[model samples]
Target: MRLTPDNDLTARAFARLDARLTRETERPVALALSGGGDSIALLRLATDWARARGRRVLALTIDHRLNVESGGWTAFAGEAARAAGANWRGLIWDGDKPQTGLTAAARAARHELIADAAREAGARVVLFAHTADDIAEADLMRAQGSTLGRVREWSPSPAWPQGRGLMLLRPLLGERRGVLRNWLAGQGADWIEDPANADPRFGRSRARQALAGAAPQAMDDARAQVGGRPTMDGEAMARVARDIGARTLAAALVCVGGGVTPPRGARLQGLTARLKAGEDFAATLCGARVEAASDGVRIMREAGELGRSGVVPLVLAPGVEAVWDGRFAFRAEQAGWSVVAARGRLASLSDADRAWINRLPAATRGAWPVLVRDAGLAPVLASEGIERRALVVERLRLALDETTHEDDLISATR
Candidate 1:
């Protein structure tokens, strides 16, 4: 579509964004604002749209506090947002620089800080002012093999909100930078350029400057090919993170939640199905894409120590524990699988006995059924010791009860 050469184009853009608000965010929306010409124009047009629909908008700005003029820029942005009838807030970031390089570190801080403000405002959908030009620049940079190149189509950046919980979005990714500038000029608005934007020392500055100095028609030609396409960088990263996090959570629950340890001993073959079904991440803490063999889990860790590969035969029974390679290992559980096993009584084993069999991970500790013979315990799955295997039947029922208890807890907590 040919955008009109007037403020009406901005109005049209806002109209399109408004239509997407429900899908992008909860009813009301939060816009990442920076009082720059591009954002100012968006704010003006979005205010009109919000008013028309009886909707509300929150404008978020982040202050890195690196420059003397940062304070002034933040205040100005807040005033403009208020003028546009949108709620506004500026989040401050003042911390010692870690090991990351200057620009890389600052961009990471800014994006995460802005997301925090958006969450505080109760916004489910976050909108950023990155226009089409930004996408072209980013795509070109990635193609050129810059450090910011994405490893996968969707994977979380090392940014926050992974633990913080936020669904980031960018609908204006389709607009051209020139169109926004031209349209903002139509409305008699002005903007200040960050002095760093002209600094040639940084690659992004150099890239933006290159685009600015290029022939207008060359940029126009580039825009024709890159017309209004959205950047899936952030969104894609979020999707991968969800998958990884879920996989990790499921693996962990097997250790601590169920009244059972993961498969151990001769049954290491049994866990083959469980771990593989859960993405094989349970045994492969390295995030390996391939399936983890028995060697991987058997070499997880030795109690407080790390685990090693090779052949390690583990027996699951009373008064015994084993630490595999990583957090992944199975405890000897002949007792937990039997009936006479009491969870409270089983947990009180002596330290000397535990050290002799220390590889036991806690996830499987509760599931191993042993005869609660006075406080100290021993495995009880043999037919010779007991007159009947009624104890075995009891242990199976307890395992079912334990599974039910864990399911209830997960549903309640979730």
Candidate 2:
């Protein structure tokens, strides 16, 4: 048997990922489709690559209900995928409402939906169509204060799953945006232009139109950093989330074991602002239940709510998929929530607590994550009579346990 250097390297990468995913799923590959020039080019490349290898491909597109041109893109993407001759599916989802700007929330919804869809289809590899130009522009956006940069996160395309431990791959991480567009044009591929992409009124729209194509100088700078920023903005944004009082919008309950998550309201508006401003940020966290104001770069928490005259009480039940605050149908999960609920304690304790608290940069220490919980504050575990959640889970769990015991005793007496 003769194996060359190239063969060995390729075999090693595929083998590592394949082994990791073997227990979870069996499908070969999945492509995230957007019906746009960049994504279409990626789809074509991946399909050709899969065909050459005699592998199956799964194509998935998330239709974010934000743009008026949304439905058109879904159909257009489906047809294009058909032309590419790959098994494809389109997921239509209600996008997150913006706390301040619409663009940031919508993109978060899109990526999350894509992740879930890929998992459901049992696809081993979830390929994203982000290009090198996207990476350069992302660096520029990160430098110039675009919040979407935080969510999309300047990582190279196909960021490997770090949170859920999913296997994600980005094949064209170093390919330039222009290269993809040129290739698509040559292939006579027609893609849709989301009208919203050009609207400067939206922060991301401005970044896409102005900075989507990076200059040579910026590209050089990003390369200087060596493969873009490795960190996603989820943790950073979560840190800067302002303390919206309980009356207006209940603080999002930490989902440690598995319970009910709370309402986010618009206090997250501040977190979005933090993403845009880079190091030091200033912005107001305005929602239906928050009233915070910032001074250009410094955030100050306060009290207030949007539409206060007749506030609609946001009442979400366990397991119900609904948009609370500006996010999507993100409820809580027992496994992940238990880990997330331990976020606050990471700071308070010493050595042992350090392991429990997910480590983030010092700059992002304060941002509390908006976790999804299953029931109403379930207990994952107890330690030294403490509930173990930032918001007291022991009290609730013990009370419930006591009530159950009493009921059982009464039944026995009867």
Candidate 3:
């Protein structure tokens, strides 16, 4: 079946995108446009949706600086967004580029840049143009021994600080790549195919090559789950008989774990099985410790991991906010302050500061970020803001419900 813009398929895609928007948000919505078929199609559809609702859309294109052609590609993306009647800007990932883990670093940088731009533009929600093909590729990667799990339709910004108070929406997961391209074709629009997509060096390209002839299916479990805290009820989880429910629980553990990535599927499965067995025990997986609480399983960041791992300290400018250790994002009142994880430095806590730090979960207390200036501890930041706050506290506050663990799973997976 051939798909075209204004056809039934496109209409359905538009409906799916519109349904996810609910009401106009308090702030503007932003779209990450890559000048690719999927994102350009999204730009066209989103601009119309925004226009009908009288809401503004900010189209942000990130130039990763990974390639010489990246600049030209971003300029094309900007033009596409403007043609679709949306405000557009290009963000460049400047500064040190790592030699190893370039792909992983670039992906993180892309999310960070887009999310930061969205925040700066006063947009609380940012939409991505990941299609069903992308989801299928993620599934393929998982099947090929990749540690990554299924990509959810809606999720929080995977990057900190920029991710704070921001929601990432993927509305095109229901649409196939061919269908989206068909829409762009009908509109006489074109897109650039990044060379990295076909390069054998990337796992994603290999996955795409493996599935070159396979048909990507529509995701059935596309319903949005309300965000909740990271904790889950042992009794409640024991009642979960469905495989999807268990996977959802696993995703929650990974989210709250504060790991750079979610744990492997087998590990998640084992954890789920242990939870369903109803045994009270404590275990660590993916940077989070899961222990049986009076009510259920309380999973929080593994404080021990913070001490072993060397985290990159962030330079905080005056009035600039950033996230540290996936737990907390804070702003400095003055410049020349550096935010670092407390870790072994907890011994430096004063009497007043220790009082507040004592209130946090023991396993995750050491993961908090503290400000330092001129080799002296910044006591005001530690006692007043940093100590009283948990890493996921801002995320929890932004969630639809402040209470409930299972209901607050941070994933947007169907």
- Per-residue lDDT of 165-255 in model 2, one digit per residue for the tens? 2334555555555666666676677876666667777655666677544453323422222211111123112222333223212222221
lDDT for each residue of candidate 3 in 359-381, tens digit (9 for 90 to 100): 76777777666667755754333
Q: What is each predicted model's overall lDDT from 0 to 1?
A: 0.46, 0.44, 0.68
Candidate 2 CA-lDDT value: 0.44
What TM-score goes with each of the models? 0.53, 0.48, 0.77
**TM-score order of candidates, best first?**
3, 1, 2
Best by lDDT: 3
Which candidate, 2 or 3, has the higher TM-score? Answer: 3
Tell me the RMSD of model 2 versus the true structure.
Answer: 15.3
User: What is candidate 1's lDDT per residue for 1-414, written digit by digit as tens?
Assistant: 344455457555665665445432234567778777678777777777777677788888878777899999999999988988998888887888665487877877777776666656656455666666665566566656664632211111123321022334444555667777777776677765678777888777777766663322212322122112111111000001211222232222222221122232333333334544543343332211122334332212111111122223233355443322212222333453233322343435556545533344443333333333333445332333322211211222222222221112111011
What is residue 368's positional error in candidate 2, in angstroms?
A: 18
Stretches of candidate 1 above 4 Å error?
A: 1-8, 23-27, 98-100, 149-158, 162-165, 213-413
Residue range with the least summed lDDT across 10 consecutive positions in model 2: 405-414
Angstrom error at residue 143, model 1: 3.3
